[model samples]
Target: MESCDAALPYTLIGLVLRQPSPPHRGAASCPSRFLRDYASRATNTLLWICLISVTSLLCRRLARLVRLWVQGSRIPGPPSNPFLGRSKLIPGCGSLGSLTGYLAELHEKYGPIVRLWLSPTQLLVSVKDTMLIKEVLIKAEDKLPLTGRAFHLAFGRSSLFVSSFEKVQKRRESLAEYMNGRISVRANIIPSEIVECVMGRVDTIMAKGTLDCGLVSQQLAFYILGSTLFGDAFLDWPKASIYEKLLITISKDGCFWASYTIPPFWSREYWKYKHMCKRLKHLTEDIIQHCVEKYDLLSKIGHSSYKDNKDIEDEARFNDSILLDNMPSGVLLQEEMAEYLTSKEELCGNILGLMFHGCLATSSLISSILTRLALHPELQQKLYAEIIAVQEKTCKLDSDDVQKMNLLMATVYESARLLPAGPLLQRCSLEHDIYLCSGVNVPAGAIMVVPLQLVQMDSYIWGKDAGRFNPLRFLSEATDHIGTHKKYEDFEKTAFLSEPKRKAAFLPFGYGTRACIGEKFATLGISTLIASLLQNYEIKLQPGSENDPKPIMSDCLLQQLLSSPEVVFTKRSKRKTWKSKGSS
Candidate 1:
C-alpha cells in the first residue's frame, strides 16, 4: 500500500504538472477538494436560511410580548391576532354606529377595559364610570384625552381639537371667559338673537310638510353657531361657513370609518382628511386674526369718541367712564378669546361630539314623546287643554305658556328614560387601582366604564317595571329616581339649590367637571323651539308611521330621531291663530 501510494503521488503530481492538461482533466481531478468546496458553500447557505427563520420567529414573539405588556396586568379582553383583532369586526357592521353597538356587546361579554387589537397594539376600552371618566376627561384636564390618532385626521393638528398641550392649555384658559358665568351672560345675547331668527326658518321647513329630524337638527344647530358668530352673513361668508363644512366633511362615510379608528395614521385615505384638517386649522387662525383686527378698529373709534365726550355733559361723562371700565379691552380680550378658543378645543370637541352624538338621539327622543302623545291623542288634547287653561289664567299668549304643559314634560322624561342617547359612556384608565362600585380592581392603565344603558334600564334603579315608557315614571316619584345615580354630582348640586331633599336618579347629562356644560343652553333652546313650534302647529305622525321608527332597527345612529314620519302640518287645522296667553 505504501509503495502504491508513493507511485500514485508521483503519477498525480506528474499529471498535474503535465505540459497542458486537457480542459476537463485539471477541472475533473481532485474530486475530494471539489466536494469540500461545494459542501462549504452549501453549509454557508443553509446557515443563512436558518438564521433568517429564527430571526423572523423572534420578531413575531417580541411583537406579541409588547402587545401583552401594553395590555397590562388586569385588563380583560378576547384573544387577539398578531395583526388586527376585533378591529376586524368593523368591516361587518355596515355603519359607524355599529361599532358602538359592537363595543357595547363586548362590554356585556368581557366587562370594562376590554383590550382590543388594532394593528398589533392593544387599546383598552371602558364603557363609562363617573369618577374614572372624570379622571380621563376633566380631572386630569387635557393631559389624558379620550381622542386617538384617528380623530386628529378629521379635525387637524392646528385645530383646537388637535392642538398640542401647551397650545391647548393656552386656549382652554382663554375660552374659560366665554364659559364662566359673567362672560357667558354677554355670549348669551348673541345665541338668543340667533334663536329668534332661526325660528322663522323652522316655520318654512315645517311648511314643506315633510322632514327628517336629522337634517333639521343639523340645520338648526349650524344656523345657530353661524348666525351667532358672524352676525347675518354666516350663511354667505366663506370662513364662518367652515363650521358646517367641517361637520359635513367629517361626517362623511369615509371620514366616519377613518375618524373612530386609532390607527388612521396608517391609512392613505386619512392623509387627505389630514390635509383638509390643516386647512381648517389655518382658517380658524385666520378668523382669530381678522377678529382681532376688527376689535382694534372698533376700539380706536370707541376711544376717540370717548375723548371727544370726556369734557362734555356730567351724566354722559360718568356713563362714558363706566362704559370704558366695563367694556373688555380689545387687545386683552382678543388674546384671551384666542386662548379660550385654543384650550377649548375639547370644548369644541365636546360640542361637536355632543352634536354628532346628540342630533339623532335628541330627534329620536322628541319623536318618541310625540308618538306617545299620538297613541293617546286624548293626552294631546288634554295637554293642549292645559296650555289653553294656563293661557286663560294669564290671558296672554306668551312664551311662558309652555310652563303649563306638564304632561308634555312628563312624556319627554319617560321617553328619555326609555331610550337615552347612549346605553353607556366610556372612561380610560390613567393609573393602577381598583374602581369601587362594581367591586372590581382593574390594573394600572386598565379602562373602567359603566353600562349606562344597563344602569338606566336597571330594575333596581328605575323599579321593577323600568322598561315600560310610562310618563308617570317622571312624576315627582320618577324624578326621585333620576339623580340618585352614583354619577350625578352636578344634578345633585342643581337639586341641592332647588330644595332640601337631594334624591334625584340616573343623570343623563353625566357628572363632575365633565358634565354637559351646555345643559342649560340645550334646555333653554329645546324648550323654546318645542313650545313655540307647538304654539303654531299640531304634530301627528305620518300615516302608517308607527312604534319603531323603522320596523327594522336602524341601530342607535338614528334610533330616536326618526321615531315619527311626516308629522302632519296643516296650519294648525284651522284652529284660532291668536289666543289669550296660555290658551291652546
Candidate 2:
C-alpha cells in the first residue's frame, strides 16, 4: 500500500504523458493538454521533494549513530553488531538476572568500565568499579529516558521518583524535610509498631506451620508502611487485600514495561499497564478518603489525645491541613509542608510512590535477610544471643535498642550486600556529557548503570569470603575481637574493604545525591522487626525445602532471593540454646 501511494504521483505523470496528442485543430483538446501537462509537472516536483527530505533525514541519523558508535568503541567492551549494536548480545527484554549477568561477564572479560550498546540509538555504560561508580553517581542525576517514561506512565509526571532534574531536587528537599521531622519526633512509636506488625505475622506463621517467605515479608512491609501512612485505621481496612494485589500487579507490570523500554501505545501490555494505573489511583484515593473520614470524628469531638505522649503529639498535629492526623509523624510532616504539594494529583502520586517504593524494597530486603538467617541456623543463634543481651538491658526493644545491637546492624548490611533489593543503580546523562576521571566521558543521553550486585560481591574488594554471609565482615577487627560495642558506629571502619574503597564498595541504599531518602527508617524498621521476631520465635527453613542461599539477579525492583524459600517459626524457649554468651 505504501509503495502504491508512492507510485501514485509517478503513475499520474506516466498516464498524462501516454495520453494521445490532442488534435491540432481542436480548441477543446488544447485546454485538455494544458491541464494534464500542469498536473504532471506539479506531481513530479512534489515526489522529488519528499524523496530528498527523507534521504536527508536518514543520512543525518546514520551519521549520528556512527559517531556514537565510534565514541563508544574507544572504551573496551564486547564487539557489537553493525546496525543492531549489542542488542543481540545483551538481552533488552530479558530478566534482570540476564542483563546483570551479561554485564558482569563484560566487566570480567574487559574491565570495570565497559561500554554497552543497548541498541543503535541507546548507549549504556556499565561501571562496576567502586571508584568509577562513585564518580558516575555523583555526576548523573536524571533517570534513563525510557525508564523515566515508564515510571511516569505508572505514576504521574509529577511523581517524586520520576521527574525533571529541577523538579526532582525540589521534591527531594521537600521529602527530606518530611522524613527528618517524622524520624525525629515519631522515632519512639515506629519500633513498637514494627514489632506489633511482625508479631501479628508470627501468629499467622505459627498457626500455618509454614509460609512463603516472600508473602510474609511482603505483608510485614505493607502493614508497617500502611500503619505509618494511614495510621491504625489501615490495619482494619477491608479493601487492604485488594490494594496490595493491585500494587503487586502494578509493580510487576511496571518492571516488565521498564525492561521492554518502549512498548507501543497500541500494545496489549501497554494498555493493561495504563488500566492498572487507573485502578491503582482510584484505590489509593479511596484509602486516603477512608482515613480522612475515620479521623473526622476525632477532629469533631476535640479529643486530641489517643494513647500516650506520642499519641498526644499526633493529635495536636491533626490541626494542620492534612486530614489524617492519626498518621503521626510522616503525615504530619506532609501536612506541615502543604506548600510543597501543589495539587491533589501530585500528592496522590507521591503517596503511591511512597507505598510502591517503600513496600517493595523493604519487603525484598526482609525476605532476603530471613532466607539467609534460616539457611544458616548458626548465624540465627548468634544473632539471637545478641538480641537476648539487648533485651536484658532494655524493658522493650526499640530504635535505641536496635542501635546497641552491632551484629544485627552488620547482618542487615551483609544481607543487603549479598542480595541488594535494587541490584542495579541506574542513572542517565540526559542533557550533558558526564566527564569522569582518566579521560572517560559518558556521552549525552547515555544510560549509566552501576551493577551493585557485582560490585558488592566482588572478591577483590570484600575478600575471598565475599559470597559468604559473614556479618562480621562489616565490623572492624577491634569490634570482632572485643565482641560487642556500646554503639554500632564505635568501629573506626565498618567495611571489610580498606581505605577509600570501603564506603563506596557497599551501596545497598545507593550513593550520591539520589540515594534513597528512607535509608534510616528502612534500617530501623527492618532491624527492629528482625529483633522482635528473634525475641519471640526461632526462624527455620521448612522441612524438605531447598536451602540454596544464592540470589537470583533480575531487572525488576526486587531481586529474586532465596528461590521461594518457605520458613517455619519456632517459638523460643526459656532455656539457653548455646553454651557461649553470644556464640552459636
State each model's C-alpha RMSD to the native.
12.5, 8.9
Q: What is the lDDT of candidate 2?
A: 0.70
TM-scores of the candidates in the order shown: 0.57, 0.77
lDDT of 1 by residue, 1-584 (tens): 22322222223345466463334433444445545655677789999999999999999878755745554434565565536655474555432255545555665678644545444444445544334444444432221243434354444333334313444455434433443432222232333344445545556776775654444455555654443333333433456546557656764433365435365578787677666665655554454444445545554666666665644333332222210122234332235543333453443343454344344344445555555555555556655655555545653333334434555555555566565555444443343343445443443333334445555565655676766655544444344554333221122122211111122335455544434444444443444445444555566656665534531233332233234445553345444433322124
Per-residue lDDT of 1-584 in model 2, one digit per residue for the tens?
Answer: 22322223244456466555433434345445656766888888999999999999999878877777777788778777535745476755333456888887788789889887777777888998878888888889887666566566677645576734655776577676666555533334444555565567667666867688888888888877887677666777888878898887777667567666456677886888788898888887788878777677655444445444665555454422232453333444445445545466776777878888888888888998888889878778877877887666655444666777777888888788887776678887666778889688777777788888788878777776677777776666633432332233433345332222256787878888788888887877788778767876788898988868567766655455557788888777764321211112
In model 1, state the lDDT of residue 347.
30
Colliding residue pairs in candidate 2: 96-554, 96-555, 97-553, 97-554
Candidate 2 RMSD to the real structure: 8.9
Cα lDDT computed for each candidate against the true fold: 0.46, 0.70
